[model samples]
Target chain A: DAGITQSPRYKITETGRQVTLMCHQTWSHSYMFWYRQDLGHGLRLIYYSAAADITDKGEVPDGYVVSRSKTENFPLTLESATRSQTSVYFCASGLDRGRSYEQYFGPGTRLTVT
Target chain B: EDKVVQSPLSLVVHEGDTVTLNCSYEVTNFRSLLWYKQEKKAPTFLFMLTSSGIEKKSGRLSSILDKKELFSILNITATQTGDSAIYLCAIGANNLFFGTGTRLTVIP
Candidate 1:
């Protein structure tokens, strides 16, 4: 069950160069998200994690950077990449988020920094 | 300030025609109200509304929620052409906020 998997599904870096978008999941979910789907700005949240090392900072977290240590990884880093950071990047997994749940996405990476 | 607003950002029906997608939120303490369906990769889960009016179907898609008019509506009755795509509205207090979607285009 690939359940959730994303990793360089597509990429074309440039600008400041430094991209890393990798998210893996196998059910062991406990909240983990990082979104970025531009064009009218639909999915923003840039980072989140509620387990493993714990992390937070969404709603377009600046340049972006995240790490969940493990519990089914959660990685998203753009360090310097720019060109508005291209777009189309989503990786989600949830089992709980306070009271909401229905998140389980991964089949997107399509970054194009130039 | 947490917010999630989705409206007629775009729409074009045809096929069986029957679409209504709208989501409004002001997040603070409220919880749960989600519906996603974005074709072309990622964005699936379709319904999840916390109480309010109690209506969540699956077959032809359905959803409902109106915590005192906070807003939430997604109903696709006979629409086809794979039901087009781009119809997302998310809101889960404490976190999760997404809107700016609603680009359904079901034509055949």
Candidate 2:
């Protein structure tokens, strides 16, 4: 396919355990983002990468780490998972060209921490 | 802090009815506003608005952004069962700020 994809569509981890969600995009977009979708919180950006090796924190980045070693891959890691981290995580990609800033999302990974 | 707020957290309407979803934002260095339609999986892109007054349309769905008012509205006409989904509004600046989203249900 020629779109974004996430691995382990569904995941479950115990509290204090480490978990990582993988995201890959085939479009080679320069901007990749990680977001968590919760009940009351629609989608809060956890981290984003402008390009390979260039990452920045977003609205909600605590307890989470992200790396973009390659342009097609951006993975999110939870150092110590907590029950509060249980939510649907989405990965998106976009271009940082002119005035267009629209993003395309992946299927999303449902993570549960108990 | 930058923020995006959506109105009418949830809505229910008949199949043939029309609905409008609102999104207001308070973001610094606002670049653009985007809308997405989510069913059970990832949210699909709907529209991206940067300028004001100009309306963007696709099939039965349309949206307009008001840069001066710092808000946007998505409208769906002749809604169908497939129109039932969560409509998300996001603001683009340094990154993207998303609203809680509006859950719309179109009943037969």
Candidate 3:
């Protein structure tokens, strides 16, 4: 009920299908981020939101969409899933200004595109 | 382009051995460097280094940053099997840029 949590801990979807991974944080941190972890690529940031209604693209943003309608929620959507899109998705929250700029991560969602 | 690169992508060692993980980065508007330990699930934060030459220590783990060389190193002394995990390094600038990470395996 506290910290950050992700939904659909594991998912398997067909290519071209749409899938949405949910992330919710109780800390209500100003910054929320979506990242995908892939072998040989590590955790690549897909999108990040500075605050509610303010989002920006990160390193690997193509084929992925993210929205932060509320400070406590940041969801990532795969409009047309591809095999390449199959990976572990992680959501993190952090405060913008503080000595602790480190992010707190969610449990993560393992998605497989078949 | 902002990038974070970790060295010795994977390592294996016996318990009681010492290991040093390296992370190098090239980014604009440098901010802070962070370390994370990832097991089967999500990554857990370890340390965040912003100032150069100051070592951040926690138990047997320690890390230091060098902004001049654009690099950082994580040292673990007397490694144990429980320490086996993927250690990730991320650079914080406009956004956090993470390295591929070093998978450390401590054999008993």
Candidate 4:
């Protein structure tokens, strides 16, 4: 009841459609991150926020956008979905950075673009 | 760019057996190495090794990092069916970089 949670655990959408996945944490971590997992690839960071209203692009942030309006929420949006965008999305939060304190991850949202 | 690589991409073992998973990395400003056990959902932290030669243990899981070799290994002894999950190795600098992960399945 007091961990990270993601909305719409599974989503199916068509190309060019806009969709947003929500992530919320109760711990109020200083850093929040979004990652995508694809077959044959592990997890790649999409976007990361250092604090409220501060966000930065990660390895694969081309088609994705993220914003942290508050320390507890970091939402990711797909401007226009594509088939290539289909993957599992994970939201993570860290007290600081790195794995020193172990970042907490959400259950993950499985998105499929048809 | 920092990178992490895991070996034996996947492994199958019987319960009560011992398994070793490997992770190697090339990171700038290295700080520590971490291991996580993922099963169906989010990955849970297993161990975080900050120094070489010293082993960290939690239950049946143990891990060691060798900074000079730029590698780490996770050992699960007396594995149980619940031990079936993806073991992810991450190298942390200022940020954390995760490897592809080793998927381990322990059968009865």
Candidate 5:
């Protein structure tokens, strides 16, 4: 209740379909991020938001889209899911400036595109 | 491109053995390095190292950063079964760039 959480912990969908992953945090942090964890690539930033209504592309933002409509919610969307998009997705939140600016991750969503 | 690389990939050791996990990075605006222990789900923070040479320790776990060499090492002494988890290293320069992580197994 006091930390970050993700919805649809596990999902399966077909290619070309649209999928959305939801992330919520109770801390109301200023920064929210989305990352995909793969076997060889590790965790890569897909998108991040500095605050509500403000988002930017990360390392790998080609097929993924993200939006932060509120300080506590940041959602990631896959407009046209591909098989290569299958991976574990993580959401994290943190303050922009602090002694502990470390991001705290959510439970993660495992998405499989068939 | 910003990148983080971890060494060994995977490791197996006895409960009493000590282990060192390595992480190296190549990125601009060098800021801080962080370590996390991921078990089944989200990664939990362990340590954050922003300064070089100064080792940070907690209980039996310690880590040091080397800005000159662009690497960091995490050390765990007297390992336990509970210590068997994927150790993740991330470099934070406004945002985080994570390594693939080292899968560690501490056999009883």
Candidate 6:
């Protein structure tokens, strides 16, 4: 109950539709991140937040948007979902700026776009 | 760009066997290395190693990092079917950079 959690563990939407995945962390960590996992690509960061209302893009930021209005919540939105956007999404919170800090991940949300 | 690479893309082993997962990295200002076990969902933290905390162990899982070599290894002893998962190795720079991950499957 004190850890990170994701909503709608599984989701499906049609191409061009808008979809949003939610993440919540109770630790109130200063740093939050969003990543996508595909078959061979491993986990690629899509966006990261340093603090409330401050967010930055990661390696794969295209086709996605993230906002952090509060320390406990970081939501990822797919403005126009595409078939390639179907993948597992993970949310993480780190106590520090990532260096020498371990991250705690949420359960993950699997999205299928067709 | 920062990068992490893992070896033995996939492995199949029988229960009770021992396995080693390898991870190497190239990053600016390396700070730490981490290992995680991923089953059906997100990855759970198994070990975190830094210059100050170079070795960490829990149960049958153990890991160590070598700053000189810029690499790390994770060893699983007397593995069970429950150990079947994707073993991920990540290197922490200013941000965390993950390796390709090793897919381990243990059969009983």
Number of the top lDDT candidate: 3
lDDT for B19 (candidate 4): 96
Clashes of each: 0, 0, 0, 0, 0, 0
User: How displaced is residue B77 in candidate 3, in Å?
Assistant: 0.8
Report lDDT (Cα) of residue A80, candidate 6: 99
Instruction: Give the per-residue lDDT of model 1 (tens digit) for B1-108.
Output: 888889988899998988898898888887788888989889898888888999999999899998998998999988999989898888877777888888888889
TM-score of chain B of each: 0.34, 0.98, 0.99, 0.97, 0.98, 0.95
**Could you give candidate 5's per-residue lDDT for residues A1-114 as a string of tens digits?**
599999999999999999999999999789888999998888889998888999999889999888777899999999999999999999999886643349899999999999
- List clashing residue pairs in candidate 4: none
Candidate 5, residues B22-107: lDDT per residue as tens digits? 99999898789999999988899999999999999999999999999999999999999999999999998757888999999999
For model 2, residues A48-82, the per-residue Cα lDDT tens digits are 99999999999899999999999999999999999
Worst lDDT 10-window in candidate 6 chain B? B47-56
Ranking by DockQ: 2, 3, 5, 6, 4, 1
Question: Would candidate 1 be rated incorrect, acceptable, medium or high by CAPRI criteria?
Answer: acceptable
Q: lDDT for every model? A: 0.87, 0.92, 0.93, 0.90, 0.92, 0.90
Place model 2 in a CAPRI quality band: high
State the weakest 10-residue window (summed lDDT) of model 6 chain A. A94-103
Better of 4 and 6 by TM-score: 4
lDDT of 3 by residue, B38-96 (tens): 99899999999999999999999999999999999999999999999999999888788
Docking class of 5: high
Candidate 1, residues A4-97: lDDT per residue as tens digits? 9998799998999788999999999888888888887788888889998999897779988898889899999889998988989999898866
The stretch of ten residues in a row with the least summed lDDT in candidate 1 chain A is: A95-104
Clashing pairs in model 2, backbone N/Cα/C closer than 3 A: none
Per-residue C-alpha lDDT of model 2 across residues B50-105, encoded as one tens digit per residue: 89999999999999999988899999999999999999998888877889999999
Error of 1 at B8 (Å): 22
